[model samples]
Target: MENKQLLEIAEQAKENAYVPYSNFHVGAALITKSGKVYTGCNIECASYGGTNCAERTAIFKAVSEGDKDIEAIAIASDNSSKNEITAPCGICRQVIAEFALDIKIILGYSKGDIKEFKIKDLLPHSFTGNDLI
Candidate 1:
């Protein structure tokens, strides 16, 4: 699917965010190499440490479903700033690296506005399974 379409899915998924604390809504959509799509939204808990980011949620869902070869991921958020593009957290980046080292990362800033990046650009010198050797 096109980046815009993936971003649109993420945008829609943002509505399901359960952010009772920060009230920040985030969403993510990832497309596996098998052409399967997975969507997820940030889910916050009463305990701060229990919160799950939208990117990680989506990645985990795909991985659980046996879709480990992710080709790309799109992330969107209700940041209310045209200049600020939503970015995945460090943990999410590492998780993505674990699955695909160079997947495309699409950041949806607003309707029809997006920035494309590679995993290496977002997280340089990232630690992956190869590092364990």
Candidate 2:
């Protein structure tokens, strides 16, 4: 599927975010190598530590379903400007690296205004599982 289509899904998914604390709603759509798509929204918690990011939510869903060959993921948020397109947080980035090293990350913006990047570009010289072993 096209990146724009995936982004559109993410845009719609953001409507389900449960962010009472930050009010920063975010959504993500992850597509696997087999073309299956999983969608997630940022789920905030009162304790904050229980909060889960949209990217990780989607990725975890895919992995749990035994679909770890991630092809790409698109993220969308309530950013009104192109300059503020949402990017994955640090924890989300590491989770993505654990599943896919060559995944494409799409930053969705006001329709048609999107940015794409390789996961490596987002987390340069990343510390992967290999570092631990």
Candidate 3:
């Protein structure tokens, strides 16, 4: 899908985020190579370590459905300030690298600013599945 449309999906998903802890709502949308899209929102748990980021949630949902060939992902957050924090977390980067290191990651802001990047761009020199053999 186009970046514009992907941003929209991410923004829509952001509305569903369940973040009672930090109040930082985040959303993610994953698009498989077969033209299927899956959306996810950040789910926070009482146990801080159990919290799941929106990016991984979306990718995992796609994987659970037997679709591992993810082509792209879109991420959106409610934060609108331009503070150079429009990026996924380290754990989320590892999760995306496991399936497809070349996947496109689109970052969206609540203020309509968007950025598109490849997984490798965000996490260069990252360890991948092939390295764990």
Candidate 4:
């Protein structure tokens, strides 16, 4: 799927975000190499450390279904002011690198506003399984 389509899916997923604390709603859409799309929304918890980010949620869902090769991923975060394009958090980036180091990452804003980057661009010299080998 195109980046625009993935952004749309992420936007739709944002509506289900359970963020009563920070009120930061985030959504993510991940496309596997096989062309299957999985969407996820941020889920907050009473214990701040227990919160799960949208990107990881989507990635975990895909992984749980036995989809390991992610071709691309789109992330959208909605804010009260200008919805600036936001990249995935540190942990999310690491998790993404674990799956696909060269995956395309699309940071999305309103609708058409987006910025694309390779996973390596976002997380250079990332620690991956190769480090353990």
List per-prediction Cα lDDT, in the order shown. Answer: 0.87, 0.89, 0.85, 0.88
- Regions more than 4 Å wrong, model 4: 80-83
Q: In candidate 1, which residue ranges exceed 4 Å CA deviation?
A: 80-83
Summed over model 3, clashes come to 0
- Candidate 1 local lDDT, residue 101: 70
Clashes of each: 0, 0, 0, 0
lDDT string, candidate 2, 23-47, tens digits:
9999999899899999999999999
Candidate 1: give the clashing pairs: none
Model 2 residue runs over 4 Å out of place are: 80-83
Candidate 1 root-mean-square deviation in Å: 1.4
lDDT of 3 at 67: 94
Q: How many angstroms is residue 91 displaced in model 3 relative to the true structure, after the best TM-score fit?
A: 0.1
Better structure of 1 and 2 per lDDT? 2
Q: What is the clash tally of candidate 2? A: 0
